[model samples]
Target: MKVSLIFPKLPETSTFIGTVKEAEKYSKDKIEFYGFPPMGILYLATYLREKNFDVSILDQFARGYSVERTLKWIKQENPDVLGFSTITTAGTGIISAEISRRVKEEINPNIKILFGNYHATFNDRRILEKYPFVDACIRGEGEKTLLEIAEKVEKDQNFEEIKGLTYRDNGRIVRNDDRPRIENMDTLPFPDRNLLGNVEYKNTVEGLELSVGKFTSAASSRGCAFQCSFCSSSMFWGKWRPRSPENIIDELSILEDQGFNNLLWVDDNFTISKKRLLKLSDLIRKEKFDFNWMAEGRVTQSSKELLNAMKQMGCKILSFGVESGSQRLLEWYNKKITLNQVYDAVKNSKKVGIDMILANFIVGAPIETREEIIETLNFSLKLDIDFPQFHILGIIPGNWIWDQMVKEKKINPDDCWEVGTAVLPIPLSEIMERIRQTHIKFMKRPSYISRQIAKTLKSRYRQKAVLQNIKNIERWDIWNSWKPFWG
Candidate 1:
């Protein structure tokens, strides 16, 4: 049986402006460039192809296909089963449902429509009940469960035995028992690069794209060891599981040979295993693999030794989860790190000569005072990181805050899939204004201006996007204030 997978295209950067830079797109397209590949679906495609299934991938997002064009292409493929993967963002789930509806109603109603990813996993039952088009959802990880579902569908057998699934029985929605998280990540095959076509990606920290040439992402591990209250990464990936240094090095070598000179380790926290990281660093140096890389890390999980080793191995950037500077707020967020730890990590990372350091801070958390928000801003500036991303705290699904909101009747569990993107503790206009002020106060300094100018001299793409982000902040102030009108 043939299988088809589709990924809806993401918005252009999701912040500064909605339009893609025509000149940049043209220049990049000449070299077969695009954003990061959807590793989730690519992994499933790999597993299915290994089992002798005819699988094809339609990356509508990377291809920049409109809904009509995507539908037309899907119809041409006309596979027995079609699947969609999505994350829980503002309008992503609703968009996925609409696409599923179009394929079912317009393309071929007989085709089985499957959904996967974070949004689908948490709202499986709700999706099945609300949308008649979505036949089933593979909750959590999809590799093994999706393969099992395909085998059953090919043979016209019952889907009841498949765990981590939510589907319809007759006319009613049925939720199955949870599936165990995949413990042996190394057992999984490398994601299907052939299915991904010639899409190019770049490794970057936060919104800053660092690599000048072709770049790609890797997962040295799965899941986050820390259960921060605002994040749902732990809920999805379950426990933390890091691949052996040997396995990780093998993938890096393959990517290096594949023309990927820069790499981004997309693990929840790349520095979770200090021992493993040091070993990986040593191996990378020993192998003489010439590749620049970056990874997300926690403030409490680094040392001078590790940072130096990473820099020596060509780690140009390191992003840290510095949610807040206030100790009270840190405790409330369950970040499990002291302010001292964050300060020390930043100092050590800078001392190690890492070219860039990104600090992610959350503003407008529930019950957060203005003083606390200001403290976070001041803390960020004092750290003097290369990049800082100030995000307004929203209730993320599968997180402690979301659960509390549901219990408190502030959010309807069944109908509030968009709560994560909406319902900020503070008004969005206020949040944006504070963020604008914070950015202006920290980023508009002479020193900061010099640093950005130097960076722009190095990266031509950064010149436009970075300046645009600063210029457009004022326009967003007016736009955000009028958000309700647009809604």
Candidate 2:
């Protein structure tokens, strides 16, 4: 069966721009223009193609592919099925529904559509009720279930018999029992890089080289181990399942041969297993592949020995999630690491000559006070890191905190899309203003200002290029373009 998977583009928001800018500023290279690739779609495409299903991936974000283009492709390819993947409160479903509606009206009325991922897993009934055109929603990991669904469509068989699926039957929604999660990580085929074509995947920064040399994307090992109450990885992958170091090295070697120089490991907790990490580092060193990779690690994970080994394995940067400095808030959020670990990690990373970017001070959580917010700001200023990102906390769905807020009557259960107001007692405007002030203060820090000046002096040519690129794009006022919730 021929299948097409679609990943939607993000709406313009200051928080998104601010996040991108922070990522760009920290890198040693000049920033290039590229949008985030839909890795999930690529993963699905890879899985389907491995099963001998004719599959294609469409990343509207990077391709600048419009609805008209999508319709044209649908009409041209005439795929038997369409699949969409989305995150909780990401608004992908709304966009997908719009496109599906248009496709039915203009292209093909009988084409089957399926939705999957975190959002659909949680809100299948609501989605099916809202969009009657949607044929089915696959829950949890979609690799096996999608293949089964494709077979059913190919044979014109009954879809209701498929497990781990939700579909409409006689004006009523029917949900099947959950499917078992895949235990053996090695069973799945490697991602289909062929689907990406010749797309140049560069980040906002230019100097940083990826292993692929052309496109920059990530391949993850395990999901997050810790439950920070605000994250959604737990909802999807359930805790963690660390992939074998050999498997990772093999993938790295393959991509390295494919001209990939810089690889980004997207695991939320890449360093949870010290033994596995050390082994992986040793393997990479032994292989002697000419590739540089970056990954996200916890503050507690950055031991002196581990940092040294990682640096030897071409680890250029270690992005630490120093969520907040205030001990009270950190404990309240169940982030087990202490403030001392944050300092030690930074010191160890620098000692190993690895650059560090501190992901710090996410504001607007429940129980957060103005004084507590100031304490966080003060803590961030004291940290010795190359770059720090300050963002307002986004209360995504399927989080423990979201459930707690619902039970405590802190926020209306139905008003999940609002962004600005704290679900807790604080007023929305006050929360927004506090976040804005914190961001401004961090930007004005002596270290940040000095670094900016040094960057301007050291790389005037690159700086000019960046400034010219920035000038050409429309800049949104920081405060004016902020959205408190997913719109």
Candidate 3:
């Protein structure tokens, strides 16, 4: 059967602006560097093709297609089954339902519509209840479930017996038993990069490429070993599992041969196991592979030796989730790492000549005071990091924080659609004001100001990028601030 898998275009208000227009506008007229392939759907398409089915991927986000354009394309494909790989961010999840509705009503009503990935996995019943256009949701890992659904549709069989599926029967919602997470990482086929079709992916620092050429993302492992309350990763991905070093390297070899010299390991926590990491680094160096890559590291697990070895393998950047500088808040979030660990990790990475150190901090968690927020910002300024990103905390669904918020009536079940679309009315004026002040203080540092001048004078691209970064700091003012979450 002909199948079409789509990654929907994000809402305009989405904080994530990876497309050309949004990226350029938000980056202060800098070069765009945010677009990346939807690896999930690509993997699904590969599995479907391996099963000898005709499959195609519509990467609306990467291609920057509009809702109308996406609908038009799906109508043209007219596949027997249409699947959307969705996420519960920036209202993309709710918007996916609308897109599905349009496909069912305006296009071929006979087509089976399926939604999968993080959002669908958690809110399967809600989706089936609210959006009649969506036929079913493939909860958790989707490869096996999706194949079974497609097979059923092809053979005109009922979906009643399918596990890991949530659908409607006789106007009543029916959610099947949950599917187990895929334990064997090597059993699955490589993501079908061919579905990407000339779509070039790259990783950049200060508007320059990470390596000599283009880059794409890969996963060395799945799930997080730590349980941070503000995160939904553990609930969705279950336990942490790493692929064999040989399996990871083999994929790297494929990408390198295909002219992708740089990679961004999108693992939830690549540094969870130091032994596996050192082994992987050794393999990369021993194989004589000349490629630059980046990965997220847990501060508690990072060490000087691991950072140094990763550097030897062309590790250009390492990101750390220093969620808050406040030790109290860190413990509240169950980060399980002290502020000292954060500092040491940064120091070690800097010593190893890691090109970039990107630290992520969340402002406005439960009971966070104005002073504590400033303390976090001040702590970030003192760190030996190249870049830092500050974002307002979200009460994500199905997380420990979400449950607490529900208990306190901070969130209402009726507002699920609103929350999914990121339209929840939470006033963040105080937080936004602090963000503005923090940016001003951070940017005014003598060394930072000097680096800005040097980089701006280096090239047109660098000038634009640096100026844009400066403008973004100013853009945090109340008038230009993002919507705040209300408790």
Which candidate ranks first by TM-score, i.e. highest? 1
Per-residue lDDT over 189-278 for candidate 2, one digit per residue giving the tens place of the 0 to 100 score: 778666865444544332222222444556556467788877768777775876788887888878877877766777887778788888
What's the TM for model 2?
Answer: 0.85
Q: Which of candidates 1 and 2 reaches a greater TM-score?
A: 1
| Order of quality (TM-score) | 1, 3, 2
Q: How far is candidate 2 from the true structure (C-alpha RMSD, Å)?
A: 5.6
State the lDDT at 445 in candidate 2.
75
Model 1, 131-214: lDDT tens digits are: 888899889988889899889989998789999999988888888899998888789888857687745554333333455556
User: Sorted on lDDT, highest at the top, how do the candidates line up?
Assistant: 3, 1, 2
TM-scores for all candidates: the values are 0.89, 0.85, 0.88
Task: Give the deviation of candidate 1 from the true structure as CA RMSD.
Answer: 4.8
Whole-model lDDT, model 3: 0.77
What C-alpha lDDT does candidate 1 achieve relative to the native structure? 0.77
Candidate 3 accuracy as TM-score? 0.88
